[model samples]
Target: MAFLELHNIHKSYFLGKEEFPVLNGIDLDFELGEFVSILGESGGGKSTLMNIIGGLDRNFEGEVRADGQLLDHKKEKQLDDYRRGTIGYIYQSYNLISHLNIVDNVLVSLNMTNLNNREKKDRAIELLKQVGLGDQLKKHPNQLSGGQKQRVAIARALASNPRVIIADEPTGALDSKNTAEVLEILEKIAAEGKLVITVTHSQDVANYGTRIVRLADGKIEDDTRLKPAYKTTVEQPNVKPKVLSAGASYKNAFQHLSYNFWRNSLIMLGTAIGLFAVLLFSGIGNGVNAFIQDQINSMINPNSITVMKNPAGKKMSTAKFEQSMSQFANDPSKLLLTDKEVNHLQNLKHVDKVEPGYQLSTYTLSYNSKNANGSGFQTWTKAYASDTVKTGHAPKANQIVLDKAQAATLTSTKKYKQLLGKKVKLTLPWIDKNNHPVQVTAELTVVGFTNGGQTGAITGTNYSTMRHLLSNAKADTQANFVSVNVNNSKNVKSVAKKITSIKDNGKYTFGAITVGDMLDTVNQYVSIASIVLAAIAGISLVVSALMIIVTMYMSVSERTKEIGILRALGERKKDIRRLFTAESVLIGLFSAALALVLAYAASLGLNHVLYSIVKFNMVQITPGNIIFTVVAAIAISFIAALLPARKASRLNPIDALSAD
Candidate 1:
């Protein structure tokens, strides 16, 4: 039994069912401490035999044995292990990764071992020093001369410390002096009790080895032996190559990404723009909804529901009802709430009070010969008692409240405050059941000033005083709308729903409106608008994802030979996939971080401008939106890279190494 054996190997190639024999039946044996050269011509099958022996080509008829155990080339994992732990290859082209420095090129092989990072670095440095290029360890491949690049290739092959070394035209591209230097190194390697097999066409190169086997037309023509000039000295290490880890894959990904920083940054910027638009729009929607709710709360009591007569059996949407309300604004009779309905609403759950209110479409107010005409008036209810009054008290019986603007018109600016105690006469108009125009008059004291309404000229009067004046003047006194108060603001929604469910004679349903209901409608519209804007923004993300896919595929094409180098160095397909995926995730993370910063800055500027007018922050970016943006970015990038990464991982090492 020998250290390595090839028993009666037979191999051939086929061109569409036509057999073209490459290697004829040949038997060979190899052992430690032997420098063997398979010298041959261009089509003599020397390289093909070396490929089979090096575990790179498995499609052949052969019985390969290492230390008497058969090498099964059909098992991919076994072939991978054999290539990683048993053989090292040196190519004529140097085949160095251009992006990595000299030290990193060697480390790319050494990383497959279980050695720690410091140990790997030290080993790489020591190997580079052995090839007499220690000072150039930090330089990239393009910075090196032809001889120096070959030296780096030799150093990289030796870094993994395999048992057998295979050199295919290793010195083919070098001058005589450099060729002699490379041969000397190979002789020394064989002297250290390791198998050194060199495949070459030069007889001068073959003479350096202890044995020469000449091949002519795929058959062995001669086998000759010579006296060796060197002896064994160094001992081989008992280390085995370990699987690459996820952390190492990511580290390699970061290195590759950093090498092309500007290109990757542009992709990140495109993705960040989309994420920023989505986040900013979502924040603005949230803020706008909040602002509307605040305004509603300030203007009307949250615990109050406005009740109106529903003329139809079916309910209408808020938008449709609002349109109808505007169209029927002049016909107050269509929206009148009967006295029986008010009594029914007062009997409902959570109902603390029901105040029937009259809305006089047109009215006039007179005080001390200063009269304001075409003024609107409403009966003051408990729900409007607090915020509507700026001074004095809410209107009761013969008392009335006027807004500050209206009071200012009836008196001098200095006397407007004093007008709170003055007596004012109100004239109201309505049509009776007989369709006749009627005017109602009442004299009342100015009790308070209203904070808001249709206009400051509008006045608030007691429901009782308006009803009494209408009765004396033979005018209809049916309430236009009623206010139903609940015990708690939180129950407003449920209470309003109950009020709408209330029906008269099983035909006429009542419509109930609370601050929450109106706010919900407003928020629904805002949410739809936000989603539309965000979707429009998402188109950029889709485009960015396509950019990432194109970039990854380009990277794969650019690094095809590097991929072969890694695959020959024992990296698994999954490791290759993970490497590319990690780079994409890093791009996504960078985009998300940039988008978050931009969104925050935009929010600050927008809120500053909006606050000057509405006194409110109108762009609120929440934590949930930030988190969603980041997650969405990462997911999109990862999905986009899947196909390219898989294509990269599936590349054949032989085909990739052979690519120009």
Candidate 2:
């Protein structure tokens, strides 16, 4: 039985919607140890017949059998095994991997082979020596001469030790002398009892073969055995291609990972920066939101609510009827709230405490050495009717409490402390002559200071002390402010809304804000920041995506002829795609991991700096950030690699082999 057979094969292509037949029914058979040459003009279907025989093109309707075994179309793995184990292909351009050394280039075909590193290295060296490239094993493809690179290509083809060697214009790129040398090698390969097939236009190459098969218009016009059957005495031991173990390809990938570090490094750099931008922006937004909330909480009194009075600016009295219409009268303050009225509001649901706060702008204080004469320190005083005190116990009737900073400034000199027990002179310079500079001497002790030392200060003495100082004179201290404390801090707003109904009845007109409301405002600001940060992050991702696209495109171009060689060697369509995608995924994963590490380091630096300055502890880096970065990187890489990977998978062996 013949070693290889092609029976009644027909092939066609579609030019748009129209059918374009390239090959008519063709038949051929070859035995082991035969040197066969197929010669024809371009587009005469010689290469197409070779493609069908090599199992690179499956579009043809045909029966291709080898060694008496019927080649089943459904058995794709079997076909792959047949191609890997039984066939060797050499291209015209000597498609050696540019990035790999000669030895590593030869081992490229063994990516699917089961051979270990040492054994594969040995086999690769043996093939290289046989092809006269033993001394060039450490050299890159670019370092080799054209003939030398072709010899390296021959070695790569034979690394898997297939039974048949298929050459498509293998000597096309070499000089006449090198062409003769390559043809001599081919003759020797046939002499080793292996079937050798050469597809070429050169009669010189065909002359070295034992048989010449001429193809014309997709048909074999002549199949002639050479007159003398050109022979070579050189013999090589029969070697079989290695079969890879389960998951060996993936394992080998790790072994070869760092071999292309430059490409991987660039890809990793792009991805790392993209992830860094995303995480840094998002984290900053969160930190800022938390900071804002803390600042608001520290600044405002938790129980305070603002009560604004309606304005009646001008007086208009046209007639007695207008005077009778007291609805528009500027007498809202005439019905001043009594202590009973203030206590009535204290009885409302969710009200844990309440206090009536009075603010007077004209009161002033003076010390022996220093004097702060601005409108009563620009602060407020509340009657401490509730049990809540920010600092020490609520002030007694004759005592006062200054904000922490104010107290500290006032007590800076020894004479200022003397004013605490002595008659401290005070004046309401803006008020009428009835309120004079009263020397109200009293036993005044400094109660605890209000307003936490960190936040801004507005709290001052209580109304009990203020009214007591003015007991000899009558003045209206019932001006309008009510502080309400809710049972639960979160329910402040709900109770404030329920109290809004009292405004229509002229009992009160006030607005309330909860800590949640303040927090919500802060969150809105942070959301805007997050959007800005996200936009910046998107820019980095865009840059990363562009980089990946360019890198993969360059890879496709650089490996164009190599892909053609692989296709000719019987790599499946899926295998080609898997190889490129595997490369992309690895690049993405490496970049993401690097980015996470960088982010963690950045967070540490940022936290340390912030703590040193504001004493505020911030910056949180979580494991989720790492996971998110990795997933985002992989997604971007896959997206960027789609077109190039598909292009690589769809490459036509003939066109790619013809490309530079």
- Once superposed on the true structure, which residue ranges of model 2 sit more than 4 Å away at CA? 11-23, 39-44, 67-82, 116-119, 174-193, 201-210, 224-274, 289-401, 404-444, 447-455, 458-524, 578-612, 617-620
Cα RMSD (angstroms) for every candidate in the order listed: 4.5, 9.0
Best by lDDT: 1
Cα displacement (angstroms), candidate 1, residue 638, comes to 2.9
Worst ten in a row by lDDT for model 1? 450-459
Which tens-of-lDDT digit does each residue in 632-659 have in candidate 1?
9999989999999999999988888888
Listed in order, each prediction's TM-score against the native is 0.82, 0.66
Pairing residues by index, what is the TM-score of model 1? 0.82
Alpha-carbon lDDT of model 1: 0.84
For residues 1-660, write the lDDT of model 2, one tens digit per residue: 478998999999898999888889999998877889999889999888877787667677989998888777556667677788778888786777676688877777775566767887898898889888877778888999999988988887777767778898898888999999998888877877778899999888888888999998888899999853334455554455544442543443333456668766877887788788787767767676767666665555555443323232222212222233345233434323456556667768888777666544444444455444433322232222232245565556655554545544555633333334433334442221343233332334555555543334443455566655545444544534566767675676768666554553543433344556557765887879787877777788888888888887887887788777666666766766666666777778888888878877887899899988766656665566567777888898878888888999888766787788
Off by over 4 Å in 1: 3-19, 25-35, 61-78, 175-181, 184-194, 222-239, 315-335, 338-340, 351-353, 358-476, 503-508
